[model samples]
Target: MLDKTKRDWWRSVVVYQIYPKSFQDTTGSGTGDLRGIIQRLDYLAQLGIDLIWLSPVFASPQVDNGYDISDYRAIDPMFGSMEDMRELIAQGKKRGIGIMMDLVLNHSSDQHPWFLQASSSRDNPYHDYYVWRDGMPDSPPNDMQAAFGGSAWTWVPQVGQYYFHQFVPQQPDLNWENPALRREIYDMILWWMEQGVEGFRLDVIDQIAKEPDRYITSNGPRLHEFLRELSRETFQKGCLVTVGEAWGADLQRAKQYSAPDGSELSMVFQFEQMMLDQQPGKEKWDLVPLPFVKMKASFARWQQGLHGCGWNSLFLDNHDLPRIVSRWGDDGAYRVQSAKLLATMLHGMQGTPYIYQGEELGMTNVRLPIQDYQDVEIQNFYQKRLGDGYPQEEIMNSIYAKGRDNARTPMQWDDSPNAGFTVGTPWLKVNPNYTAINAQSQLADPDSVFHYYRKLIALRKQYPVFVEGDFALLEAEHPRLFVYRRAWQGEELLVVCNFGGEATPWQLTQEWEDAQVLLSNYPQHPGDLRPWEAKIFYRKNGAAGES
Candidate 1:
């Protein structure tokens, strides 16, 4: 549980992450643009979001979907111009919403001026801006593997050296070891801050402070020093919300990155909870059922361990993940019920909640064949598996369950053609279920997933207990039930969710029998919970038979 006496505006904020390229397209370019996002400000405001975390639309070759930055100062032509971006900021502010940009500090595009000059000659001024090592043409300097699976080092023929890249070859890892490079990045951060941008979502920030010799990922020895330096240079200016995408961070590292001392960042997104269903010693493409005890223990530890020390980023789906309803809930026969249940579990937790675009409508993953997939990581994976003689169906099946493209599908705004996302053809296929699942269909239905999410967000804003309350986990071993309680001052909230596909007994103690319902997915429930049902109950101290 969090300390109710200590309050921060961001703790009660609801963030919505929008992938610009898939959000909407107003120019008939078959890709979403800034103008498209601006047109939807009211739509997002209606959903009760306080902040918008837009994915990168910076100048790039689109190798990793704008992540490989060619220029930090300009918007990609495909996404409209700088004027459009500024207009978005001004308009969002009018609605009481702030904007968070995706800041990719770990690397720059190989086509970037810095990388191009660095690759030109060993004595070039920008040569030290990126990581490079002397090695034989055919051999890498080390045995480190790239994130998408391969040697981390790529040969640069003109420079007669190998440069390190944690992702694809087009994305070259920057050398934070150099004082000049770090300053350049810091200056860029300040430049955006000066543009009325509220904050940044630091991309792969944990990998930025890698060991100079080993290329290891996650919390390096110099991580604290670097983060503190960033805070001193950028975050100290105001109440901007800076979050890091920390992939392999541990509990201790999580505490350090966003501690109350304000030396590092506002918070960080850790992948442990997202990786619960992944098999050990296997790649992310491999999937398994989530272990109840393991997940329960993890949730409890993080909640208690970081109680007053740091903050957590509460989420279930993002642009890089499969839809939550499809992955963690019953999406076949009970999609709506399960989606609402997942939302209840997410918003009831003690942390700032993040809603990925289209998640509010209970979007499910699209089962696309290999040919229909449109993601760089998925393309590379499928190519490798095909070359390795893996069956096509086996590869497609794995992709169907864990593909990043699942979350990248065009937004389903209405039942019209193309889901009303774009007047032109969409870059990727829209989910075929949009006809029945789009926002237009749900907006009119009071019991739709959209309304449920709206209610959850409104509750967080209205109740202090949902924001700064203490959390207590129950039924740690209950395979079907996710039971937890949040207490603040004299108010206690009991949140019970059924993650299974069948009815389960509600083991209420005597004190909890008279609990009044605050919210419920279904109209009513007697002694048992229906499949994927969720409910929250309110009780005050000494109010009833005391559970």
Candidate 2:
């Protein structure tokens, strides 16, 4: 059995994700580069960040942004050279922060050397590096729909076969069944680690072992076996953190993946809570109001399910999702309070929290026209909806609410021409609210959302309750109040948040009446929670005390 006393370093630290293209642009190329990140190390260090999970900067065709990797060993010139990456890693280590690269292994860009050779002819040595099926020029082997909309199989007339792709056709799925391909992937991973990368965030990792012919796209038969083999060859050799993006994972599967036995992964990113705002059994574009009751139940289930064995990755915003403040909280009148409330509730949970770039500044969604959106997924869906005779207004409304580009706007650094992100035109337009919500303004204000998030990060590191505590939900049936308790050893923390725009009365228990106020959005509790108020009270030995 593994020793239970020594905890991993990742459990107590917070992770900040940086989408490179939109973070900062120092080259005036309208795109962010590695030098831009190196220049901002002091800002991240001041934010109490312990790790940075950077999105893909590898050599790519930019079809799916950087996710469509064309070369695994080279850095794209758009971002920078290998020397710039080395400097960023070295600089981050100086500030006690580590780098975690996003690993896209499920597929590679069609322009990749392997794919180019595989499509040249069926007799080539690299013919088996990708998933291909022999069929007529117009027909495919299976009736499967691609994640973006149309057919999953793309006809390759050069080889007289159809290649499978879960995403866009430009990204062909790699054949993991071939040991030679797996060996190549392992070698590339080790090479990056040798360059001083501390960890990896596996993108769409669950689909690597997919059995496409049988319509099995996730958690396939050889999933665990392949994961264990990958772990033994790479992550097990050092104290490295590996998180798999498993959107299809549930509580039971998360336990197996994060069993702490050093077999599969460190943790899994489950999307149960992210789907709560969508209609049941419908696509994400078919939206619905935020299901408060169902959202609470999902959170409690994961918190209690993965308490002792598996771990969870707490996040509400990412490169592929809309900003949480705009999607769930009020981003108009009570933006600051609601943003802090959302952060407090998430940080008080039992997991390692992740803060996406501009999220701490309460960045909101953009209402740009269809032509202004740059994401491939959004463009594909918009065209499909238009072809289906849907009104332009209806399609745009969904885009405004859930489009991936909502989170891809340039970082709002100041009230400059391009929000201080670029000297030239930005790759994507900056949010217009940058005039009121920018890092320059927030850094000067003590009561800003950025400082609130910093305090939350500090609390997680200073208190054991945030890491090893057992979570229990309070007032589970309440519609407007989100209440929970975290207890560890003799320390207890009561976290309450009013998830509405009106003042709500909450009856505080006698055990928490005089508890030390560890943190709160408001100055003091006046027998009622103000609009979007959030408070965290600390107690010890059944009595109030300093925390």
Candidate 3:
């Protein structure tokens, strides 16, 4: 069954996620702000996106690039004033785009008033706002490790207890077991909804309910109850979109998290495929070549497992990961083709496609020295690896390959001194190749990656097949080619992506030989698929969508 509202509101929509701090800086404060986003609404509209997902512009202490939210209702001064936020909402509506705020309900910055009061004394009413334990005063409460690194528990001598934080020491994990705390969070969410924000991307929402008496975290027994309650309270009230950042969610868990009854979220992001390149038992900075067969298998499982049951979110990179071109595609010789190939593969599937900022311009990863890096996790990784006796060059290379900062660099708007992101000094170094690879250069070129992406987005809007199609993997064993077919109402799209930098023979079966090309990175139909090539063919009843 579809959602009860039957809105079909988010199915074919495309979302462009903007890490506000690095998107554009107009305040001369060396940081992107609400005003910057307001100024670029036209630019975003030109991309043909239906929604803009801003990555946490709320008041923060910059401990984790705004993810460590200090205030739920106030806009950060560094980003803009509350008036600027209201203006952004009004202006964005005028441009025919909806705004989705990133809601970090999983944790709050330790500097937040509640946390401060909670940490002050045992008699404080807010003491239970966060998870606090008084066990083994000299030792941690548990053996759990923080997602960033080190012990998850921190000693708070002021309260004579240790507080649990799933991330850094400064971000205390909220205790959802407390009904009063839950009420406060829900109230904050309603306040944002009242301000005209249409949707929210729930940050680490699955981890909001931690299991009892366990060192591990997330997916506690009452997880579904909490999500269902939150949904009934906030999203179900209106046709608002909500997606959860579920780190280890599988197909079954995802189905429950985003049930067809609409009791929970619209969809949940699974990190299994994202972690396919990670070396097990090592830090995130540890990199390994992506296993192709595994990647194909994981994607196919999600596509098949969620079909007719739940929903899927299609994406390659986001603010917390390395650029897609550098990781899965060739960032050097075949950068443009590979970028287009990845886009074609993602958008042709049966899911809501997400385009991260600068991705439309085929932005590759930044190679910054250790001294130039700004991400706290990256710096922490470097120091940890160095203390563990790893070589400096190897650690630096690892950081270059997998550091989150690679995707956090300022967007390359033009070939200006600071890539046109800012008139003053940039908070982070712009990618050096921005001169050759930037939005301005691509926008002027007809055969640019940006144009190809625009075409893909338009096609999805034009055809319901892209939104409500049944998916099937064409060649499960094809090593270099990722082939998938989506069919709906006698309309089908055959998407073939050559993932490697080598030419290979690719021909359709006799039954599908009459397919006509709907999209392709290359100009001509190559009997042998070129390196890093992608082609999307549309087959109608007895003819093709295009000749």
Which candidate has the top score in TM-score?
2
Pairs that collide in candidate 3 are none
- TM-score for each predicted model, relative to the true structure: 0.96, 0.97, 0.97
Off by over 4 Å in 3: 1-6, 542-547
Give the higher-TM-score candidate: 1 or 2.
2
Report the lDDT tens digits of candidate 2 across residue range 166-249: 999999999999999999999899999899898899999999998888999889999989999998898877778889999999
lDDT of 1: 0.88
lDDT of 3 by residue, 1-547 (tens): 1142444588768999999999999978788888889888988888898888999988889899998988999999988899998998899888778889999998999999999999999889999999988876668767888878898889988888989998999999999999999999889989888998878899998888885357548888788899999998888877887889999697899999777778899998888888988798766667888988889889889988888889999999899989999999999999999999999999998888899999999998988878898898988888988999999999988888888988989999999888999998889889999999998889899899999999999999887789888888877887898998888877888999999989989888776788888899999854899999899888787544432
The candidates, ranked best first by lDDT, are: 2, 1, 3
lDDT of 3 at 293: 81
Ten residues in sequence with the least summed lDDT for candidate 2: 1-10
Candidate with the greatest lDDT versus the true structure: 2
Q: Candidate 1: which stretches are off by over 4 Å?
A: 1-7, 542-547
Q: Between 2 and 3, whose TM-score is larger? A: 2
The collision pairs in model 2 are: none
Alpha-carbon lDDT of model 3: 0.88
